[model samples]
Target chain A: MSSVYVHFFSVSLDGFGTGEGLSREEPFGHAGERLHEWIFVTRGWKEGGSGGVDDAFVQRHDMGIGAEIMGAGKFGYPGWENDPDWKGWWGPNPPFHTPTFVLTHHTRPSIEMEGGTTFHFRDTSPAEALEEARAAAGGQHIRIGGGAKTIRSFLAERLIDHMHVAVVPILLGRGERLWDGQEGLERDYAIESVSSPSGVTHLTFTRR
Target chain B: MSSVYVHFFSVSLDGFGTGEGLSREEPFGHAGERLHEWIFVTRGWKEGGSGGVDDAFVQRHDMGIGAEIMGAGKFGYPGWENDPDWKGWWGPNPPFHTPTFVLTHHTRPSIEMEGGTTFHFRDTSPAEALEEARAAAGGQHIRIGGGAKTIRSFLAERLIDHMHVAVVPILLGRGERLWDGQEGLERDYAIESVSSPSGVTHLTFTRR
Candidate 1:
């Protein structure tokens, strides 16, 4: 069965997901970078195209994912303004050679990238996006890439099947947190996997 | 001294930001659009940009920000991984004519745009980026544009001068939350403003 999973997401010491000031140049902003300090050093990230990566966790993250789902913020707000001629920050041949789906309000024409990548925007709704995503996966797995709010939306509907988090040893003290006021979750999730290298704890949780 | 604030970020009723698969195209995913539903409607947004933008909150957010910040996820992962031809998601003369700062780990060249816009990447820490932001504002305020974890960083540290949230009437049981488990802060902040317009509660909190 196709399931929703939050993968490759990094957390801060104070439980922040990202840092402030999400600039393309400095996307994580302050602690945002620190949150991913653990993952960036992981081998999983290095294998995934993050240059000169370190640690074994990064290796795990890059290998086990087949596809990605991200929010408009993940694409850059400037990209959406005035419906201008902007592709994304990643440029043409984005790192994700795999198929990607976007959830947006203003509809856009489908954008196909090199390396077997096609960006399809769905405003139909989450359920609709999920259906389309399942069909689009082509038997490969789908990793739900989040921008905080995006992740919360799917988790609320209880549609997520698994979540992979790289718990780094740092704190944002603000920006976005991991479990800030999330209501009515089963709370009893089993750890599917765990890896420890460079003090970053990689945890995979599956629905109970 | 320049201060950072997390303004107009939204969350769903279910606590999720968007629904399901995430992509650069639909970074916010599902109802993630609802988060910014208020900002675009603000008097500021309407009076400045297109005419008679419906929502009041959105208009205000659009009216203008001191300066904007970007996170890695918000900017798009797979850094510099572009065709080298495409730019960002926004068109020329973007909504923000102000100088913007990017939070990044990789030290790349700065990206300059038209309309007094220049994208500067900070390989330093978030505080260092804030220093640059303060200088760039030249007396104006600084906005901590978020992706989730970015916002959390500021919140946990209580580095924010003010936080204005447009609580959309929706929920995303997952993703990220504005305020998670940030400890060691003065909780006695004052509620500076509150409104329930367009089924969204516009709340402003200021440090004591």
Candidate 2:
């Protein structure tokens, strides 16, 4: 079955998926590369890196994903919309080889970048966006790529079937938090945790 | 050396130490026993319980500790001060066998309970209260007994030397959170994580 899920999403111990003051120069803002340091050192990232448990998890980002739903921030920096030449953060060939939907207030025409990825912009609610992405997904699973707000919206509407959150051991105290207004959300899911030797804990929430 | 630390403090994956609407009947509030089920099944808590890593960690609550600093909410329900006869939620023999300081504006006389635990009320800052607790510790160690707010205050001031936060699998979307205004709090400490088989990840932070 085609499932809607999130994988390899890294967050700080304080629940921040990303930090404040985001820009083109600092994609993760003051958080820099700290939240993703665990994945960056994995064998999937470097040729000579250790292929341990961290690498084993990082290798699942692309699994069976046929489509992706991302927020505007993930597509580009804050004001990238004004720059007509802004294709995306990914130079020519993006990481996602599937159809990607970018949720934003200002809609734009679909831009087919290099490789098999295409960026489709839309100004709609999470449910509406999911409907479009799911169709584009064919029979494969849909991955929720986030800047935190996008993920929260999907969770609020109870659309996520599975989620994997990597909790890095840093304190990015003042940023986009992932747990606000989510009281009693655990009732619908069975959550489990696994701590890696690299000092990060992976929390997996599978819908019950 | 005698250190200032926190031990066996359980929090949800969202970083909440205690839930909303804490009362005498529901000490952990809406969270109920879900946040502490990991410790309750430990050998240190009950007879014939599991004596693995979880129990090994739970048994350290009273080891090498002399005094404690807690928030008013942890001492009793919200309006506990109105009832002068209210000793505490811990009954006659409270678990704490040391001089415990309760931070509150309504100062009251010290009440010496059974098991050598004394409840002392004081309206002071974290530094001032820690100084008194350290003295009462008698050169042993001081444990930070919390209700989330007290621990946040201590963290804001960098007064803690060691901390062990158990990340339980459940999510208390609405409650007193443990991380806020603590940006870059991890810089001063070396952090590590270990996931127990009981579905709780223990996070330890030691001063660098």
* The best candidate in terms of lDDT: 2
Can you write out model 2's per-residue Cα lDDT over B1-208, one digit (the tens) per residue?
A: 6789889888988888888878888988899989988888999999999998898889888778989999998888989989899988887999888999999998899999999999999999999999999889999999998978998899888889999988987778878888878888778989989998888899888888
Candidate 1 per-residue C-alpha lDDT over B126-152 given as tens digits, one digit per residue, 9 for 90 to 100 = 677777788888877788877677766
lDDT by residue for model 1 (A1-208), tens: 6566786677643456777766657777655455665555434555544333235434544544456777777776534635557666677788777778877776688888877677877676666677777777766667778877677677666667887766554435667655555543435455432324344545555778
| DockQ comparisons of all candidates to the true complex | 0.04, 0.81
lDDT of 2 by residue, A69-120 (tens): 9999888988998988898888889988889999988888999988889999
Candidate 1 stretches with Cα past 4 Å from truth are A46-56, A62-66, A184-188, A192-197, B1-208
The lDDT for every candidate, in the order shown, is 0.61, 0.88
Task: State the TM-score of the second chain for every model.
Answer: 0.79, 0.96
Here the TM-score of candidate 1's chain B is 0.79
